[model samples]
Target chain A: MSDREVGGAAEAAAAVIPGSRAMLAVIARSLSPLHGQVTVPQFRILVILADSNVALRSGDLAKALDVHPSTLVRMADRLVARGLIRRSENSASRRETLIELEPAGLDVVRTVTRRRQRDLRRILERMTSGERAAFVDAMQSFTRAAAADADADLTSFGL
Target chain B: MSDREVGGAAEAAAAVIPGSRAMLAVIARSLSPLHGQVTVPQFRILVILADSNVALRSGDLAKALDVHPSTLVRMADRLVARGLIRRSENSASRRETLIELEPAGLDVVRTVTRRRQRDLRRILERMTSGERAAFVDAMQSFTRAAAADADADLTSFGL
Candidate 1:
């Protein structure tokens, strides 16, 4: 491809991430209270555990969130300190740790989830049903484009 | 309101923020180098300046971003270091400083805009023209909804 074509492809490939970042700032601002009570990394770990059907390894969690394994380890340590999650060695892979939400973790997730659901519904109520559907569809499309733009690589980040 | 009614209302009101946050994470990841180079707050400052018709005071920027005036001041310090933006004393208000993007800041915003437009076009290319229109409309709706939801008194944060 020509240099201009390459730049076009690169831009096409990376555009949604910043757009989503703009959206996330609003989301983060709305949910800032949670950070006053719980750190973002810790909250993310809780959400992963709460939403999972079974316990997952740190590597798996890291991969899913597209965070470095070291970052996940630090977050897991904080969660354990807060009694929101428990981590134990995986017998099959001693180096790997399996993590699950504890009772407190579940409670935290429940509270956060409830609050989040309320906020989402309120936003939706403001929009016509058609708008809501369109929003969700655009989100899905943006995500799909992003995933492709990332070259579908997640194993290294464990995402 | 009844206890249950209040709980339900709170939940409905809180949901959109997190969902939008998750979507933003995906978007930010997709955009890559733009964020890799600048912190989100710094980028926000740049965006606001880019969108502004005239230089803005720290208070106006703080209010626009739902951040503390001190936070904007600190961010402005960093931006000045990067030479991306500059601050000038407001003649009308001795205590107020007007923030404006420097040439570097303008260039950065311009590149980001071009990249985003290309990205949107590429993503839209995957769908019919009607779908693209719907997608932009959805994003605008989402922005409005989040902005309205955010209008709820954040005065506690001194915002």
Candidate 2:
């Protein structure tokens, strides 16, 4: 897996790229049961709201989600239909309508999170202590480094 | 960050949980530019097709994507309209529609991947050699272990 000629980034990418897909697969499986209940995009929106602990302006949410305003409107429309989220009355006239997660929306986040935690725990337990400790240390280091990077992506509904 | 009382899974989860969000943020940032060009859900479908390298049966694709049949059809409907993918004529009456990625669809996956690689490389390069090595080893180890786990998620469009 080491490409001496393509040192640094390319080699590093080659070494760890497979892990990205594996990690995503882990998350996706957690979302499987709720497939019909909520689309992936909707779930992301719910996560951001849950993390923020407050209603978000539609425009701000759209920007954070990296969707066009119209697209957010459309996605929000579906959420409204499903009653996972709703538009809060906005007293601030200059700002866009504020959207808030409903109790139902919180359930989706909780369900998937609980599932992922269980799966991750199972996998972690199977690893030798060296592998498990390395896994955790590397993950934490990467997160810390990436979060500090100005270029770190803001798109995942600000997840 | 260590929770002594919550050993094993709970402890491991604590160490790596933050990284999960950071890693997702990295991916979400890569997908940011494609926000309007392709909705996140739609992009996911295209990625599945691109990776598969052949027309996928609508039913199988739906199952692999972990989406309801009706939802896949709806998502595919937009993709078809946008010319990112198309329905291939299927001779077998028993099979559902076959979806093939168009040139346009390939382009989208390529763009995001290129961006993500560039971003990841930059991040990897900034790390100490030890950190980078741990990342590669841990990532590969985790991918291998998770892939082997019978309970590992299959909901991420077979990615």
Candidate 3:
């Protein structure tokens, strides 16, 4: 496309995307309390552990988060220091270490997630019920498509 | 709400939000070239210039971006160094400096934005036409609400 046409398309797209970039920033700001306690990467780790309900080996956690093993190790060290997560030797594999969320970590995730929910609920309340239903359906479809791409990427990596 | 109830609400909200957090990460990854050349905050500056179609005072740019003056200055310096943006003293006011996108900067913005549009279009293609229309409507509503909140905050700040 010509530069002018590209600019026009971008303006149109920007109008349609609902300022999601800004809303995401606002949501992140609302989670400042949790951020004060743990960085976003660490919080992700906690969330993964809370969601899985099982200890994950270090390599597995790194793979799941798409972070380098060394980066994950550093983040894990910080979380361990803060008592938000624990590192334990894997029973099934003597050479591997398992990462698990602590009670405190779970609490943090719960609190932050609840706050995010309340914030999102307020946003949804601005729309009519029909709009909300439509949004839910549309978003579900988008997420499904994105998840499929993620799965394909994982498969390529032999994950 | 009780903790359990809050947890349930959060889970439901998570299911409904279409993994926006992850989608954002994916989008950011797709813009890796732009990111490698300019940080996100710097890119926002170029976008603002492109959208306004006119030069903006440094203070006004910082205000629009919700960033600290020092931070904006640092980012501007980097952009200027890369020749993507230019900084000039305002002719009307010696104390004020104007920031404008260089041709290079505008080109970069257009390229990245077009790439983003293509990425979003691919995702939308996975949905039926009806779903795409519904999504556009829903996202428009959500963006309007978020913009209103932003305006309210700005007003409260006497900006």
For each of the candidates, the C-alpha root-mean-square deviation to the true structure, in angstroms, is: 6.6, 4.8, 6.2
Q: After superposing candidate 2, which stretches have Cα over 4 Å from the reference? A: A1-6, A32-42, A53-63, A66-108, A151-159, B1-6, B68-78, B90-97, B151-159
lDDT of 2 by residue, A53-126 (tens): 89999988887777799999999999999988999778867556999999988888888877778778877877
Query: How close to the true structure is residue B7 of candidate 2, measured as C-alpha lDDT?
Result: 75
List the candidate numbers ranked by lDDT, top first.
2, 3, 1
Give the per-residue lDDT of model 1 (tens digit) for B55-139.
Answer: 9988988887778889888988988998999989989989888999999987776666565556545554555445555556666
> What does candidate 2's lDDT look like per residue over B95-138, in tens digits?
66899999999999888887777777877877887888889989
List residue ranges in candidate 3 displaced over 4 A.
A1-15, A22-26, A150-159, B1-15, B19-22, B63-67, B151-159
Clashing pairs in 2: none
Stretches of candidate 1 exceeding 4 Å from the true structure: A1-26, A60-69, A128-159, B1-26, B66-68, B137-159
Please report how far candidate 2 places residue A148 from its true position, in Å: 1.1
**Lowest-lDDT window of 10 residues in candidate 1 chain A?**
A150-159
**How would you class the docking of model 3?**
acceptable
Q: lDDT at A59 for candidate 1? A: 90
Please list the C-alpha lDDT of all candidates, in the order they appear. Answer: 0.63, 0.78, 0.69
For candidate 2 chain A, which ten residues in a row score worst on lDDT? A150-159
Candidate 1 global TM-score:
0.68
